[model samples]
Target chain A: MISALQSVPFESVLAGGLLIGFAALLLFAFNGRIAGVCGITFSLIKHHPTLPSMTWRWLFLGGLVAGTLLYHFLTNTPFPEPPNNSLPLLIGGGLLVGYGTSMGSGCTSGHGVCGIARFSTRSITATACFMAAGIVSLFVFKHLFGWSI
Target chain B: MNQKIIALLAGLLFGAGLAASGMNDSNVVQGFLDVSGDWNPSLMFVMAAALMVTIPGFQYFLRRKPIFAQGFQLPSLKSIDRQLVIGAIIFGAGWGLVGLCPGPAIAALGYLNWEGVVFVLAMLAGAKLRQVQTT
Candidate 1:
């Protein structure tokens, strides 16, 4: 476990967190919006009645793709190979994520970061539930069944 | 126009953060989840640091009206209902299986792979199905 810690790059992780926080700050300060990716995606597909406009969602998502490409370009970091999981696994997981986030009303970025920051009880509970579920499921699927995900 | 530009910039930063933090990699996330095995504490640090900044920033920002919009748009629902818990658990199971959520899945598109494309499409389809059910 300690050896695993050694491989975990602290510098990049810290930088990434700061960047994410700052990004959320920018959105909240300037645009009065939470930088929740799942919510943003869902709103794009189905317009929310209360929101002002849809263009920002497209631009924000576009920026996500562009930002990733920019990181690889500037840092010359090679993209990790796609997991060896089967197509069905990928589709099934994706479907659950989409449906669950929509039903639950947020994902990690929404509830974990933005909602938690605001001291929202619902977000807090959701975060705990997801974290617990993730741990248990990983324990069952990966450790017990030896599934490589 | 300025709001859109800011949104774009914020997204770029957010995406870069996701890439830099190694959250874009499913294996890294899985490692974090695999506590009984070789546990990785990176995700904890990322969320901790993010909350440090976000909590302060939001506190300050909430005091004033937003520059672009008429007001700050926050979640109004506070109920800890069954749907929220059940949805989160189901989502968590999926996350455990794949180690890719909506954010990372979208960012993974930078790799320009079919898997990312397929996952994203399936995600959208699932969300649509959920919407249909709710409505």
Candidate 2:
């Protein structure tokens, strides 16, 4: 049983979920932001110089950075090293996501968590696309491209 | 004073949760994506855990009226049209190639992962490209 837990990578998942939920709760409680990555990112870009909700955006973004820093401090855990990947692939992937987020009107957080929770049809549609794209992409890369990152 | 402020606090806690749960780790996420290689079911567990909390949290919120805005703004669209299909295909492709998505990818920044930086830059670019095309 102990060995099973060790092999399962339980700590990371628990920590991740807790932080995500806490962030959602905080956003709802203090800023009422929904913690949707797509919306936040979009707003940052769409209304750049004249940030309409600058304070909340800053605070929300700040909390994201601060929460992680605090967790590391409290747990005394060393941060994990970044995964290895080519620069091109990394850049390309980001571009694709950016495009998708705009087209879909939200990313996983907006659609997956906030959207789904709110039972937003648009979010459901968007999230479905997000997940489907993820699954299909994995298949192509692994089988067709024979690429493993 | 505003609901946006409340949202920011929620986002912070959510980011913290991601860190705490270790979902920010690409390797772990990669493990889930990698069906052939040492399948890691930990992602499922993390998701389940999140759902457990979220389900109740949402229910509680539903019972009460929106404290800030008019009401809970749910997505109204129902059709799984062309945009939905195409977008999903693209998103899945990206996720498959790289085990980073918007949520976990951003959360990864807390760990100071360079890849997170790269992913975010690309993600922003992707978002911008779409905006330009649409406009």
**Strongest candidate by DockQ:** 1
Best by TM-score: 1
lDDT of every model, 2 decimals: 0.88, 0.66
Off by over 4 Å in 2: A1-8, A29-32, A47-50, B1-5, B68-78
lDDT of 2 at B50: 62
**Candidate 1 off by > 4 Å:** A2-8, A47-52
lDDT tens digits by residue: candidate 1, A1-100 = 6454234479988988888899888999899999999999987777354556888998999999899888878988778666556899889888988999
How far residue A72's Cα lies from its native spot in candidate 2, in Å, is: 1.6
Tens digit per residue, CA lDDT, model 1, B1-135: 999999999999999988888888888888888899988877898898888899998888888888888999888888899999999998998888888889989999989888888889989998999988888
**lDDT tens digits, residues B21-131, model 2?**
655666655666666556666666666666566556766776665567555554455776777667756766676667777776776777766788989988888877777
- Model 1 docking category: medium
